[model samples]
Target: MTGDTQSWRRAAPASPVTLDDVARRAGVSLATASRALGEHPHVAAATRARVREAAEALDYVASPEAARLAGGPTGRVAVLVPHPSRWFFGELIEGLEAALRAADLDLVLFRVGGPEERAAFFDRLPARRKVDAVVVLAVAVDDAEHARLASLGVDVVVAGGRVAPYPSVGIDDHGAGRQAMDHLLHLGHRRIGLIAVDDDARASAWRTALADAGIEPEDELATTVAWGGEGGAEGMARLLGLRTPPTAVFAHDDETALGAIRTLRRAGLRVPEDLSVIGVDDHPLAALTDLTTVAQPVREQGRRAGELVAAALRGDLQEPLAEVLPTRLVLRGTTSPPGAPR
Candidate 1:
């Protein structure tokens, strides 16, 4: 029986119903039916209804090209990332691609990392004729850019930050900062150092969270460094040289935290003993390093952003679309009560 089933499964199925058949059934031109299927705004409501009914009866599914011919979507989404090579952006792109693939759509990646690239890309509106939606990663842009993005007539989904009038998906950086501060406060750390990166918003959030916790972070203790381990090491080295060096450090991301740990180890200091460390993102390396940190759903954020794009395309987004995921502190070997025995 299994062998017979296998042979049957190998047989080809019938060809899909085409737009011509739908048009014929609806008593309209192929172009009209295509326009109706695309849901072109110019198509009259009555004609669109008739054509859609015909398509349903015929089970007609329009191909990507057919849909575009009718002024519909191109079945492609453009993902804009600040730094494609960075670990965080890489993880996000992976999740976005996975979700897009599941929906039978295509992904087009655009790296607009620096100011020049970003300005050039936006000015050209390269996605205008290329994609149906745009997913912008963690990058700051002014109101004009956001408005220009919307004017391109493509659905925009902002991931990792909020741009009004467009759906956004990300964890609250300020809230996550508060959680990190809360964890460290309970651990009895007074002077905390921050190994921050290029994200000014997140840096400000961390500072605000600290202040709200009644812990005024010292200006000299917080240093803006490069992204990743190298930058983290440099920031830690500077922090360690301070007259009143911090007993604990909170890095912006896990890579930064790992780098800080490397610096401390080389300086003959022990983690959670001489100086505890905590970071955000719970990066892949965080577990290996046993780093105590706040973990947000990076991949999930991307997936949800993709889902939002799909929803907007289907006209399923009747309300303002926004998804703020939660983050939690993952306690590990890197953090402990200050002055506690190792």
Candidate 2:
């Protein structure tokens, strides 16, 4: 009985071992094999030879999919952006396209704006085994979104939000927070207020305390708003109604900042005199309002993300890390030393 059992185990099935199977046999990784055979000039030649031998003995053929990307074939990279016309997403896509073109990779742009389109995207993906990888730019996705992407069994990198188990690229939103707050502190603003984005109040609080900057917002100092200009105006209106209003304000983004300006001016408050204001995102509209901001290098961050993703695609990148970029404080006419609230 023992002899038969051992013999049967030894005489395994004739089906070809996959890349996963070969990695296990070689005491390396699927990534290692791809690095050994592909364009990873950094891998040791001896290591490459070992992988090749194990691959040969197992009669393992490279996945047609891997060859298209990891190898020398013309491959496609799918880039998913939530919306197309938004400035941040548009700049990110431009950077992604620049990188892909440099590598002669095909770029498939998809705008998964709503429920129906997202469903169609995922449904069409299973058959797109030939596609190399995916890039999610600035789209805060839920678990269901991630699960669908994982089901496709392809390399993935997310930009702008922290999607776990996948490498991500973003500015220290918290640092951008600190920078924004620092500007206010330098302007002698103690009675400051905030127009927050969405319902993520913790993010708002954390950003204030980040990098050891800004006033800890009192209950009367900070207010939550929606994601756009209306939210900004509404939050500012609430701040103005308080017994002691803020001398200055910071909004979540440029759009919100503009709304804050509208509210302040309509209330007979003077900019930089009665109520100084600022925001994040150096969006084009921000300039038209002459708003101060923590200017993020949107396109540069996108380019860096592209480079990081490319390194992952080549199998030469092993260390898992969060890449953080820098942001700057851009001063305009809107911000000044805090004065008496009007």
Candidate 3:
């Protein structure tokens, strides 16, 4: 019971649906019937339709667990994430909850995962035994770790970043990163700086995006660590202390952006005059702070992930599919041309 654990476990069967019964009526292979019901990628549309037609004729019904045995399903799903405190997490939870509720299944939530705890999670195969699948949100894990998840036979879907052998759902982080940097560049910010999380996967992607944009050629790229505010403030302080300090800054997230803004103001700098700033995430605070940002479709991402999970649960789709949501630019008071004399 790690992430989003909910009620309705071991509930009495809602109705009974038999794969064998469907297969026999459809005159397809039993395995084909399973794939058709699960909507797996390899199964042909024609065969799937024929199988569904057979199933409808039989008035088939099934328990979640039973269907998983014959298809790619489990009665419960686990939503694994880092950083339990944030508006983003809340939005993600809403989508996951809605999906599970509709399917009459359970959702488990696990947060603040470490190597040992993660190992325990895999060993338990909770997602396989107690849940049908898992959704990982903006959390960092390696290819090896993802392989471990695959070995456990739990359907996995990631909402941020990417993992091997697992279909993912996310907006283009690189495009998002470029958008952030491009905003600063457009404002005539040659001395732009970055405040990023210390995640290898995410870090590499963001940095590459900045490089490709031809904004910061080499020494201009300064790296600093922060997943949220405190780290962001420290990073900003360091950047500001440089002899040729950046005139504009982009924090990886809203919290980090706010931190940079705070650090600059404390150093007797006038925002948008002495300093221009931007960040991703139009967190509620962004409007309050008047910070310009690129807003990802957060709740919408959650809703889509939820719907995808639900589709797999309801035998509507086969195998996990990757999805890309969009991001929007929200202009506010924080950004301006660098060194616009106040």
Each prediction's Cα lDDT score? 0.80, 0.74, 0.71
* lDDT score at residue 115, model 1, on the 0-100 scale: 85
Residue 180, candidate 3: C-alpha displacement in angstroms: 1.5
lDDT of 3 by residue, 1-342 (tens): 633344445454555657677877876544457657776554567778888899888788755653664555346678887765777888777776776677665778877456776677666663445566678877766776666665444456676556554556778776777777777776777777777776443355455655666754444446667567787788888887787887877778898889888888898889889888888878889998899998987777776777666554334554446788887778888888977877
lDDT of 1 at 39: 74
TM-score-better candidate, 2 vs 3: 2
TM-score, model 3 to reference: 0.75
* Two-way lDDT contest, 1 vs 3, winner: 1
Ten contiguous residues with the weakest lDDT in model 1 = 311-320
Candidate 1 lDDT, 217-303, residue by residue in tens: 689988999888999999999999999999888888899888989999999998888999999998888898799989999988888
Collision count for each candidate, in order: 0, 0, 16
TM-score of 1: 0.78
Per-residue error for 228 in candidate 1, Å, reads: 1.2
Ranking by TM-score: 2, 1, 3
Q: What digit string (tens of lDDT, one per residue) describes model 2 on residues 1-342? A: 999999999997877567777666766545556656675553556666777888888888888765543454336778888788877888888877787777666778888888888878877886655566788887777788777776555567777656676778877776786677778877777777878885453246434563355345486677888777888999999999999998888788888888988988898889988888889989998888788998888887677667766665555455556777778889998988876443
Clash list (residue pairs), candidate 1: none
Clashes of 3: 16
